[model samples]
Target: MTAAHCTFFGESNPETVQSMQGCMRKLKLMVPKLRVQKRVKELEFIQHVIEYIRDLELILSEDESYTPHSTQISPISPHLDSTYRP
Candidate 1:
């Protein structure tokens, strides 16, 4: 979980950070739906998995904040915002 050598997220940028925030908001909104699972064991596992993913996200964010990403690769096009869908 070193800040300078993140292996999971690869890189960060304005668009990528924005998208991740948006997706996280959407996932939180879906938590209630997860509570309706008929099997308790399955529900617990699903919740654990989601928590694990969120933990990774936290690590990624912290890494980006504490390290320099100026040399990292970014796929976002500065010219595509006007036509981009997501």
Candidate 2:
């Protein structure tokens, strides 16, 4: 049967069939590369978070002031008391 007659199975013409075949070819070409690209992106994101955490650790370790208000006190103290105070 002609492609036009095959429309009873699905609403597809000759041009639509050709387009679908092209899309399938493109998807076959891209799927593997897309997966690799996604993995690279995830690794980059993890690296960025690791670097950010490292920088944050350095910032927290170094004695610095982060006073937001007059009543605000430093969370980290050089001296640790025997009792834990909230």
Candidate 3:
């Protein structure tokens, strides 16, 4: 039996970078569900994904040489409040 592991490569290609940036921009446009705070699990999941995407954006922005698409890295807008208790 053989074990498998997943690996992630930092994409430096101009076209792929542009596509990823576009997808991230589109993700930011998503609207939260009505009364999302009521759903604790869903809210937590959303927060986790948002944090991950922000981390990815930070990595992309740090590579100044790969900016064939756009040099501007806009922060994702906050759709949910940080201090919400269920």
In TM-score terms, which candidate is top? 3
> What's each prediction's TM-score?
0.30, 0.29, 0.33
Q: Which is better, 1 or 2, measured by TM-score?
A: 1
Q: What is the C-alpha RMSD of each candidate to the true structure, in Å?
A: 16.2, 21.0, 15.1
Worst 10 residues of 2 by lDDT: 77-86
List candidate 2 stretches off by more than 4 Å. 1-40, 64-86
Residue-wise lDDT of candidate 1 within 1-86, one digit each (tens)? 23333222865877766666565444444444333444445456556447645754555566655455467765634433232221
What's the CA error at residue 56 for candidate 3, in Å? 0.5
Show pairs that collide, candidate 2.
Answer: none
Q: What lDDT is obtained when candidate 1 is compared to the true structure?
A: 0.48
For model 3, how does the per-residue alpha-carbon lDDT over 1-86 read when each residue is reduced to its tens digit?
11111111586777766665555344434424323333346456467557655655665577687575876876644623342222
In Å, residue 36's CA in model 1 sits off its true spot by 16
lDDT of each: 0.48, 0.45, 0.48
Clashes of 2: 0
Model 3 residue runs over 4 Å out of place are 1-40, 68-86
